[model samples]
Target: MRYLWYLLPWQFSPAVLTVCVLTVALYLRGLLMLKRNGAPVGFWRPFVFFLGLAVSYAVLQTYFDFLAQHSFWVHCLQQLILHHLGPALIVLSGPVLVLREGLPRAGRTGAPRVLREMRLDWLRKPLRLAWRTLQHPLIAPLLFVGLIFFWLIPRVHFATMIDTRRYLLMNWSMFADGLLFWWVILAPKEEQGSAAVGYKVRLLILPFISMTQIVIGAYISLVPWQLYPIYALCGRALAISPMLDQQIGGLLTWIPGAMMSLVGVIVVLRHMMREEEAQLRMSPLRAETPGSSRPSAEVA
Candidate 1:
């Protein structure tokens, strides 16, 4: 039991703590603003948003952090949750909408107005460019896949594990990219107009992305030799054999990661179907059909 306790990675990360606190603060501020304005804030929005934050803190700041550093399989599981599940929940929580509505209204005179104007001026151009770039159907998925490949390179992966800065960068980048990719796919209808890539295009490209992840995971799992030297050089802290650990990691990435991508594909398909149904309902031909009972239908 003491050995197990020794194995636990309980080191505090100031960076992780700061980030988690900021996330909660920002979200709470938005919720407060929403309530002040008499907006109907659903219970689930805050719940899911906070859940994502909690998952992030769990993996980065708790015992899971130690396990991830020591075990290949645990690291893979961490990535899956951080890059796929956690971000999905955050996006679903509708932070963008909440934040937008939460912003104070600008007025002709006062410090609040001045602050608001300055904030808008500072944010407008850069935010617009970022939004445009992310909205491109190919950009988010390609960047996401590219990041996975980039980090999986033996040298890159080893560097990240050895260097604290690099490790933080890897985790934060994956989280940010995950949020962007999922938000592109699952944004509310009012925001869909800003997306450069239509739902059909997003749907078409998703399968290819899923296939790439599967291929990468399969390669890692099937290889006879270990790709990462650090895992071998640094003794395995857990009971599992290095080879078995590598295989488990590969399978986790191959299966659960692909499943998350599949969920995005399903969302896109549903959105397309809904749009098609709406279009059909609004069609003049449908309204004028012989079976229709309205006066306009009878005139037709």
Candidate 2:
């Protein structure tokens, strides 16, 4: 019973619960529909997606949130889930594909018609245009890196921790931006239209952002002074000294955060390799190995 109590929300939000439940129900429905059609709806993707969603929710609603508020390192760990690991896992699961089909037929087909009838059709183009602009390769990398620095500013970080509204807003922005950034980095180019960024561009962006994290992290970890004094004010959950807490937080920001970038690069490279293999398989003439004496052969 004590263990079960820890699973409950520390400060329950009906809106968060509704969104999470709705998505789970919709995803399950979509899975059933796909299975009925003999589409290959595998086990792992849905599992990963749910796990990702659960992690984000856990940090916010579980006893973890209480610990996070009182400890700088725990807070950084919470941010990592909300901003990196959770969103990356969610995107990798292909939720967009399932969620689209999960919608009712009327909702899918009649949405445009209803919008037109309501004289809100003009909103569609502008929304799409805005999305494209935001997802632009250059802009995306900037925003992804910039947001981290923005929130890390000692003053801003202090205010965000103390104020409930700002705290909620900060969490929301982190999750949303994370989704957008990871989708750009990981989504297969073959399935994408204009949203597909070049592999080279994504590769470049990941390293740059990772380096930025390392720089900031090293500074924080090595600095003699306490960068964020809010934990001291609020009283730390852990018994460690303030410097130790700050150093641990800096290491978390340095290591796992940059690790996400490394993982993103590997995913991108795999996508590139798969696409190349596909092209080679489809083409009759193939490039011969440099060391092989045999000439290029026709593929079956």
Candidate 3:
């Protein structure tokens, strides 16, 4: 009974717990400041903090369960959640303005020395040259669909076939890439630019991207298949029961990930619309005032 602390994976890694606690504490402190001092909870702060907490919980839970016994399906579930859902949330959580004020002044510095030395011109050339090529309307949908199949590859799914460490790294890297790629099209204008297409246009595009996962999952679920054979022995040895586990994993990936991502797109679009409306309302008042745009209530 005294050793109950062992039940928590966060206890095993003080660093992970430390980061999670600090992040939540910062958000809570910001919330208190907003309540008391009329501070704004910057656009992305709430979402970023939410993402951090969710990822931390998912990672810790997976780590501890793995330590208890290596179940192939459990590992797959963890990877899918960490890479597919978690990192996407993390990226969407970005451009946090509330957290901006909380950060020390040092972090606000622009263009580090390392960045200055990096030859960005060469890298930026192709992106500029073939902006249209890079802007293929199908790229985002393909990435989302490709991710569904890529993970199911027997080599990737099988833990023993590849180095577990490398697999984890690849999963995280791919997740990050997916987030960045989609963001190029779906990203909010407040953080980037107000393009020819408005937030409403982006809202329409989001459904197409989100549905890719659902279609892939439904196909896999209905088909007769064994996508990850290497895991068969491991699952049997570790009592994972692959068929049942795979079905659940597919459902988990298909349902929550797509739904959450669509929700994020909707939230961002709403935020953009609200900001635009506020600006429009303020514009007329600013124009009417001839002198400085400050409120005039001077009685001495």
Candidate 4:
């Protein structure tokens, strides 16, 4: 009976709950559109894919993050899902076809109208703004490096540990920033209005970015010194040795997180290459004129 509380499923933060509910609602709306006679069938697959991802996220949060005992590896896994994988998957699963069809029959007239307008001007204003911002070239490299530096800073890391708001804010912000940075570089040219870089370029750039973390982790791992005093306090509170705790946290930050980043870069680079090749193939063919006989030849 004493361990009954631990047996209860994990609880989600309000933000997670809201997102989950919205995802489910959107999925249902898509289904409703399918049933309606006038609605288009374009949105079903994308809606289903996104809905599935949302449900997977919910399960991870409820079963792994909320219910399981606090372990560094578990925390790393959660971060991989909520931060690295989730944002990219959701963005890639944009509701272009589905939203177009579903929103019309969603029974929400205002939203439908707005979405229609957005569909007309989507890339022009909102998405264009985001695209330009993310592709600055400066933003991605800086963010890639800055996140590690900020994480290593004693005050910043400790602040995150002490304040739930700070922890959530820092992690979520970095994750969003990372996704946005990559999105600009990897998004389809039609949507982005500018060709994404070649896959070869991305392969180089992505590895270069990931290497920063490998270096940071190596440095932290080699240093015998304790960078954060809070680790000692946390160790005492949690009844784990301070050195072991710090090492575990460092490993979580270093290995799995870095691997996730590297993997994303690889995938995005591959997509960029395929997009470039497709564009090359689809480009208008140049008209070739056969050599014209000299007019002088007729006179001769």
TM-scores, each model vs. reference: 0.82, 0.91, 0.62, 0.65
What lDDT does model 1 reach? 0.77
* Candidate 3 residue lDDT tens string, 1-300: 545654555324454467667766765655665656676666575766487457635555434445322444455456555545555555466534545444445433432423345645455546544543433445544655576566666676564334656554544555555555445544555444222234555565567656866776565455566665555644343544666655665676667657755675766677666654665576757646556452221100
Clashes of each: 0, 0, 1, 1
Candidate 3 weakest ten by summed lDDT: 291-300
Candidate 1 lDDT, 63-107, residue by residue in tens: 788888889989999988888888898887778767655444543
Better of 1 and 2 by lDDT: 2
By lDDT, is 2 or 4 better?
Answer: 2
User: Could you give candidate 4's per-residue lDDT for residues 1-300 as a string of tens digits?
Assistant: 656644334644677557667755776676567668565446655654575466345534555544112443344445555555665565566544444445544444543355576576454567556566566555666666677577567777777766768766765666667556556545543443352443455556666666776676666655687766664554343456556655766676667657766666766766756654554455423212235432322221
Q: Best by TM-score, which number?
A: 2
Residue pairs in candidate 2 whose N, alpha carbon or C atoms collide under 3 angstroms: none
Please list all clashing residue pairs in model 4, or write none if there are none: 43-98
Off by over 4 Å in 3: 1-57, 60-76, 88-95, 98-107, 112-114, 117-141, 159-162, 178-187, 193-201, 236-240, 282-300
Candidates by TM-score, descending order: 2, 1, 4, 3
